[model samples]
Structure formats: structure tokens, C-alpha cells
Target chain A: MPTWSRRSPPGWSWPMAEKKMVDVFSDVERETAMTANPAGYAVTELGAEDERIVTLAADMSNTVAEFIAKFPERYIECGIAETNSVSLAAGLASAGLIPYIYSMSPFGMLKTCEQWRTDVDYNHLPVRLVGRLSGLAMGYFGTSHYAVEDIAIARTMNNTVVLSPGDAASCVSLMRSTASLEVPVYIRIAEAVSRVYDEAPDYEFGKWPRLRTGSDVTLIGHGMGLGLCAAAAEALYEHDSIEADVFDAAYLRPYDETALLASAAKTGHVLTVEEHSVAGGLGSLVAEAIARAGLSVRLGQVALPDKDLEVGVPADLYEYYGLTPSNVAAKARSLVRR
Target chain B: MPADITLERGRALTEAELLRRADWVRLQTIDLIAQAGLGHYSSTFSCAELVATLYYHALRLRPAEPNWPDRDRFLLGKGHVATGLWPVLADLGYYPHDWLKQFGKVGSPLNDHPNMKLAHGIDFSSGSLGHNLSVGAGMALAARLTGRDYRTFVLTGDGELQEGQVWEAAMAASHYKLGNLVAIIDANGFSGAGPTSQAMNIEPLAKRFEAFGWTVREIDGHHAPVLLRTFDELPDPASEEPVAIIARTRKGHGVEFMEKQPQAWHLGLLNAEQYADVVAEISARMELANG
Candidate 1:
């Protein structure tokens, strides 16, 4: 009943406080961990449970097909025929079997886009679209292979739910749930496995989970970028007095309205981070929500440029675009001081 | 000649009725296109008899229950001729005849192409060429998976063969040996810009399908009895391979003015005098059959 304050004391902590600590999970760690790339192990586990879950790859199996070989009958080796593979998967989806259509991000999502839209989305059919190497994960593969515009295009569709899971556990949970989903789901799979949540990490579709809470600044990131945000938050606390609240938005299309509002209200300053183009990534969605809700938060966007990214490794590109922890921490410091 | 039948039924379609309906379907397509200001009339006219044969006699479908699991599926891969499909569907009681009255109107479900979500009796939305064949392949596979005896039919324009996805499905169908699936290619010489031979010519059409492990057949598209006989006697999906029926057709079969003229392929409007000529011509053909 006390007067509410953005910087409320410890007594004001919500139920989410008990679930805030990051538990260590070692099932699918790739030497390093981040908040992005939740789908790696879950995709593998879902493949283990269901024999009908097939993964079709267009020459890229290293980064995305880890789970495919576990169930051979559930995988098809279609070399470079993106359109045919998509159409065939759509056909297979009709057979009551879930088919995960996988390929590189740009080639998979944009190359056979028309076929995907026609065969999968328009049909309102449940065909899992997996963009294996999302965003700048192609590294030296250059601008031609980078899938920076996927979120925007996928958002325009009717029955297609776009997902950018930020850890292995979330990815596995979402993949398993997609079996019963009536609509199409597009998962942008990051090249590296970032973080592993605790065994009891309850995941929900279209809902954002708050990892860290602070009153000074709110940091929002999705998919692979979420790890960067989490890393940046830790850096900010060590170097500067600013405490930032970090939220992981797994579903890109339907943003979590309640989490977005609460975060925006808590901190007048909000920053969105993504590996996709700044034009239509999480930044655009958060900004739109802020404007709609009539909230007066100063929104800062951190995403790749609208133009094609230069050739480099995923880490180099992430650093080049100030997507690394130190760079994000510096950007947050500058914005908070302003 | 009368269509081959079980003898007691006499014919799949009376020769006179076949001739009259084929002509009617052709002219009606032209009229609808002209009225709607859009259609693939040339392609529609070419496949008129084949479509008429299926609707009037061959396909075991119930218009009342379009989603009946046991009902046979007829998927039109070349969906530009949605104008032609409307009347045939209406005649078959798939929809009311008055539904065509709103063709091309704003917000009307009856667009230039068929959309499964927007329109009833349409199993799949097509227009992005070569898609329906794969969808039909899936439907055929679904029948097998569900243990249903229903067969699946897909019609693709010969020009649409240029799409590589079609060949992919063609290969899949052959490899899976989907004999319950019959793909009919309306081999009209002309396409959108000009004659297909002048565009990207693909000849020996039936041979190409055969190489893909399909049971292929070539037939005169204008001949209704031949089409009826083949459709009625189609093999089961358990056959060694899928089936492809290549229908050799002229661009515009009944309408002399539009015949072979690709420009007239889908003119959705005809002046009063032109309309009169079409009506008179159809009247004469009907009278000749009656006499």
C-alpha cells in the first residue's frame, strides 16, 4: 500500500525474484554460452522422441542437423533444391508428420520464400521452418548468405509464428510444442549454443522471461543477441553503478505485451538488441509497443545495419556491430548518462 | 462416338451432350472472363472437355460435402483459369451458380486465381506455378496413410512444366509410385507471352514423364469419350508408378476468333457485337445437336 517507486527496496521484490538465479546446465554447452540459440539441444531432443519429425537440409547439416541423424527416417538429404524441399515438406506436413525444413538463413527463408508462403503459411499448415545459420552466423559467407530480413518478412504473414529462442532449453521446449501447434513456426537457429537454463526452467510460447531487474535501464534482446545483453548487463554492473533489467524475448512476431509494459514502466530508458536488421527486428517491435502504450520511455535500438554486413566470422561481425558485451555495456553507459 | 460405360448406364456422356457442353464451357469461360475483366480463357478453353468429362461423369465427388474424406480430389495446378472453374463447379453443385456473379468484384473470394482459404471446393490455393502437383502428391499420400480409396487428380498447364519444382514432384511421385495420383498436362501450344515452343520449348512431353517413372499416356484433349474412358479406368496408387495424361489441345478450341491468338487468352470483356456472335455460334451448335 506504500507509494510505488521505480527504485523500490528489497521488500518490493515480486515472485519472479526466486526464479531469477541462472542455474548451470551442462547438457549442450559449446565451450561458451550466451542468451541466444536456445533451439540446438531441444531440436535434437524433439528429433529423439518423434520418428515422424523429419529434417530436410539444403547442404547445411553441420550447424543445424545435429538432431536430424538421431532419427534417420525423420531426415531427408535434398541437395540445393530449396524450393522442392520446401514444397515436399509442405506435402509431408499434410501426411500428419511434422517436417522441419532446414537450410542457411538467407537461402532457406528468402530463396524459397514464395514456396514457403504458399505451401506452408497460406495453408496454415504445421511445417517447421528452421533457418540454421541465422543473422550473421554465416561469418565469412558474407552479405549474400546473411539472413537479416527474416523477422520482417515472417511478421507480415497471417498464421506464421516467428521464434528466436535465446538458449538450448527454450529451443527444445518450443520445438516439442510445435508438434501440436496448428500454425506454422519459423525458428532462426544460431550457429553456436549459448546458455543452458536450470532443469526446472518453465518455458512458454509468446511470453518473455525476465532474467535480471533494475530500475535505471531495461535491456531487451532476442535469440542470439540475448546472451550479448546478459553479458552486457554483467559488465555494466561491474564497471558502472547502473543496474539494467534484461528480458529474453523468444517469440519475435507476437511480443509479450505484459513483460514489455512492465519493463518499460520500470525504467524510462529501454534498449532492444537483435542480430537482425535494425529496421524490423526486436527494436522496431519494442518501439512500436512503447508508442502504442503512450509510455514515455527513451528507446534505444541496437541491431545490425539495414545494409548487408561485411564478410567476417560471427564473433568478428558481432564485435564489428558493437554486439559484444563490452561494446553493448559502453553503449548502455552512454545512453543511461544521456 | 458414345463414351465407354458399364453397358447398363450406356455412356459416360452422350456424344451430343459432350459436344454441346464442351462448347458451352468454352463460351461460358470467354463470357465470364470478358465480364470479369480477367481470366486465362485460352488455357480454360483448351482443357474445357477434360474438365467437363471429370465433372459430368468421371470424378466420384459430392458437391454438398467438399471435404468428404472418401471423395476424389481434383486439383487444378494451373489456376489462372479460375473463371472456367467457377461455372463447372456451380454446375456440379459445389457452389451456387449466382456466386460467379461477383467475379472480380472488390473483396470477392473469386479472384483471378483460386485460393483454398478464400474459396470453397478448392483443395489448395494455386497460381504460383507447379505448386498444386506437389500438394496433390501429398493428398495422394494422405489417402494411403489414412487407408482411403479416394484418388487424387492434378492438372498442370504444359507451359508450367518450365518450373523445376514440377519435375521434383514428378520425381517424387515416380519414386513413391503414387499410381492413385493422375497428373493431366493441358498441352496447349501457347502460354502467357507466346507459344511455348517459341518460349522455352519442352517437347516429347510424355517421354519426359515416362523417364521420371510415371505411367504416361498422350490423348486428344478435345475428345471427351477418350478422356472419360481413361479417367474411369485409371490404375490404383499401388501401381509401379504414377500416371501422367498429356492432353494435346489447341489454345482456343471452340471460339474461332480467339483460336491460336495468345492475346485473346484471357480477355475478360467482349463488346456487345462480339458477345452476340459467340451466343449465336453456341446456339447453332446446340441446335445442330438437338436436330
Candidate 2:
């Protein structure tokens, strides 16, 4: 076998992502006919097989126009009432129809948190709540639109499944995964996370994707934080001679901890990364897993700080919050060093 | 006086017979609450006639087939009054008589509030206020979509109207023009702290609902015969307008002490002496009605 080389192959880093923090998805967006709105396409695809599927939104007809175009009679427009939309979805579910309640993240998941808990969760109904424009994706809209605490709020509901897909294809497939489940599902989706996956990977409920492998550190990322990990793996190998095992923790609730823990046995350190509050997010889940299993390995977490965020573009916000690939790699290096 | 059991509408019981049924429900409710040593009797007492009329006459229910797809749906928005409902279900044989004595006891499915998962007769679980009407709206919509003639009725406490979700549902019902849906506000005037007016004034209730595109009607809720007639004559769903029946009522009507002292009766336990007095009072009413 040939010996490994520590040096760069040919000027790859170029100061490592100093290009532009403004429009990050521009490159991948141009090459692909992908969209951030995957629920519409998934509804169309799922409705072809199951006509019992209904779509209800809080005046989000344009947002879920695809479902309307496919089956106009089944779509309901509730006009900016998230609570009514959720309760209505519960009602629809009670009548043996699979209803998907769609809206912006803050309103859909956070605003209607009680309805999700009491009506849908307590009753054990299968209502797919799609919170698009998650994270700080709608950067200029301020805290009203930001949904950093949704995953924490959603995952606490018993018998509920929470998912955060990193790309367009994963989003559609995750929507498909929610259709057949008997319990409620809350999908936290980002508006634009391009270039994370070239082709759609096979989807399975309650299972995460182990994208890359290494011996030093295992990086756990969820939602758009996942794409960051996938990108960081390449930079870490080339520039720092560090190989990290990356995992897309799409299923945040009912998460299968076997693969993650097994990877930890091989690699001694685990660092959870997420674009959510450090308090009750992927980091908290991983920490719980580590402590519950009585593992002696070190656990590091890189996540958004527990504070109000500044209003700017998401890329700039990511940089300010130390979510850039360089900062991610740096955090990984610290975990390995520890 | 004893309720008159003469048929009024082809095969329907007259107003007096309906009132006797209401009194019977109220008597059962007092005993159930006194037995558990915990219940919202006022909440239950106020809706007696409304419940009695619907179960005995108005609603289309196959008691043997409680889960029948075409059966009318009844959602109790004020679930603290679930004690009043349990007896009705038992009387109809929705559940066994054994479960009746186990209310509020540990290991029993019965609780302080309605739990549909634990109980078979309950249509929707509704401890949280202001949500059931929206759920009722949903059922009404399902009836529309499925081409089922089943009507959906939601009985809400006047206090529960304070919750914003009720108005949201009100707007939604009007927007869809779900004439198959009917909302009866158990406007018993007493709420959590005291009289609802002092707590949150929801006066001009009829005009407010009418403004929201519902055909509003005000009636004496205790007049079960009148309620049955009203239920029979209400606008059909084909009319493209929802109905809101404002059932004007007293919190605790049948019993003297409870009716006079409605403030604390929202939730109260009867001591041994108080329990005897309540039983005696209801017995006197039944004795007078028997004459």
C-alpha cells in the first residue's frame, strides 16, 4: 500500500471558504432543478397513490400550491390560523385522512405547540406538520420567523416522530416516511440546503445516514447542520489531516442510537453540531445518550448559542455563530485533542 | 309536577317528559359528583337539558354501535362536567355498569376530565378548553366530504369562550359555512373564578356570532322539549350557514342550595350532611313530579 501524504495535493484550501459568506447555495442551486419546498412535490407523489391525503395550511395556498394543483378539492386554506389548522388537521385525521399542516416554521411548529401536544399527540393521530423556512433561513424577518427551539419543543411529545431533512431529495423522502406512520410527525426543514447530496439517498424512518468514517472523531449534525458536516469532512481531510466520521441525524426523535454509539466505540470522541439551541437540540440528545450509556468518552458540541440571534443573511448568521466549515473543523480538532 | 310523557312530534316526548329526563340526569349527576367527592357539578348541571334532549331524541345514535360511521358526533368542550355525561352513556349501555362506581379512583379509566382513549363513548378527548369546537368543525367538514348526513354538536362553557381558539373555530365554521355544525354555549353565567360577566364580558353573544356568518338563536336551555323542537327545525347544511344555539341557563338549577350558591359550585365536594341534603332535595323534586 502507498504511504499517506499529509500535505495538500494542489492549493485546495485557498484560506478555506473565505470566498463569500453572502449567497452560499448559489453554486448548487444553478446546476440542479431542486427546490426548498419539498412538501408540495412529496404531497403530489404521495397523493397519486393515496387519495385520502389532504393538505391544510394557514393561508399558505401558494406555499402548498402543488397539492392544490394535484387535488383542489382536498386542500383547505385556514387563513393565518395555525391553531385552527392543527386542530382541523387532527379532525381530518380522525376521519381516516392523512392531513399535512404546512406553514412557516415559527408559526407551524412553535406557535401551535399546544395543539400539537394536546390534540394530535394525546389522541395519537397521524398529522404531518411541515415547518419550512426553518432555522435562520428567513434571515431578514427577525426572531418572529426564526425556529431554533422547534426541535426541542417537538421531540418532547410522546410517540411523536421528528425529522429534519438536509436537502431537497431527503425532504421528499422523509415526507414519504411520515405518511404510513400511525403517530404524529413534525418535519423541521430548511429553505435551501443545496449540494449536500448529489442524488437522493434511500430513505428509512427512525434511521440516520452515516456518511463518512474516521477513527479520531465522530461529528453528529442534524438538519442543515448536516450539510455543514458533509462539507467539513472534505476540508478536514485535506487541510488538517483529520478524518471524521459524519452522521446525518435526520430522525431527531426515536433516534437510533446504536450506530452513533458503535461509532463512538471506534472513535473515542463525539461532537454534536446543529443550527439549534444548544440547550435542547441534537447536542442535548447526544449528551443524554452518552450519560445514559455510561460511556467514558469525551463529548463535544458545536451549536448555536442560547441567545437571541442578529438579523442578517443565514450565511453571515452562520459565520457569526461559528457554524462555518472552518470553525466546525476547529471544534472537531479540539475534541480530538481533548 | 311529574314530566308529561305524551308524544309531541310524531314520536317525540313532550316538553314536560323531556324536562323530567333532564331532572333525572341532574339527579344522577349530583349523586355521581357526591360519590367521587370531586366533580364540576355546576358545569354538568347547566347542560342537563341540552344533553338530555340530544341523547333521548335529537341525535341519531345506534347505542349498540357507538362508533358507527354515520352516527352524529357530540364533543363536550367543558370536560370537567364529564361526570354528567358518564351516566348518560351508561344509561344508553355505552359502557358496563361496573365502571360507573370506579369514577375518580386510581386504576380506573375515568378521570376528572374526559379521556376518549380510556372511555369508549367519548368522541373527542377535551380537557383543554376551546379546542373541541374546532374539532367539531372538522367532524362537520368530514361529514360534508363523505356525503354523510351526520351533524356535529359542540357544547362549550361560557367561560371557555374566553379562549381565542373558540373564535378561531367560530370563524372557520363560518368560512366553510358548515351548517351541519351546531355550537351550544352552556351560558350558565358562572365561570372559573365567579360570574362570567365579571371575569370576561362576552355579552351580545348572539350578535357577535351572527356577525361571524352564523344564524344565531337564544333559548331557555332547561326547556328540553323546546330544545328538541329547535334542533329539529334548525337550518340544514344545504343552507350554507352554520348555527349557534345560545342556551341561556343557570349554573345549578334543580337544587335550592346549589342553585342559590352558584359561585362555589363550579367545583365542590358534598360532606355527609350536604350529600344527604342534595339527595333529599332531588328526591323531593322527583316526588313532586311523580304527582
**TM-score for each prediction?**
0.86, 0.92
List model 1 lDDT by residue over B143-254, tens digit each: 6655777778899998899888898888767765678888999998877877788889888897899888988889998886787777767776567578999999888778
lDDT of 1 by residue, A125-151 (tens): 888888877887766756787888988
Number of the top TM-score candidate: 2
Runs in model 2 with CA error above 4 Å?
Answer: A1-34, B1-11
> Per-prediction DockQ scores?
0.34, 0.59
True contacts kept of 1: 0.46
For model 1, the DockQ equals 0.34
DockQ of 2: 0.59
lDDT of 2 by residue, A22-92 (tens): 45335446353335456677887898889878888897787678778878888888888999889888887
In the range B174-238, model 2's lDDT, one tens digit per residue, is 89879999998999998878989998899889998998899888999987666877888888656
User: Residue A137 error for model 1, in Å?
Assistant: 2.2
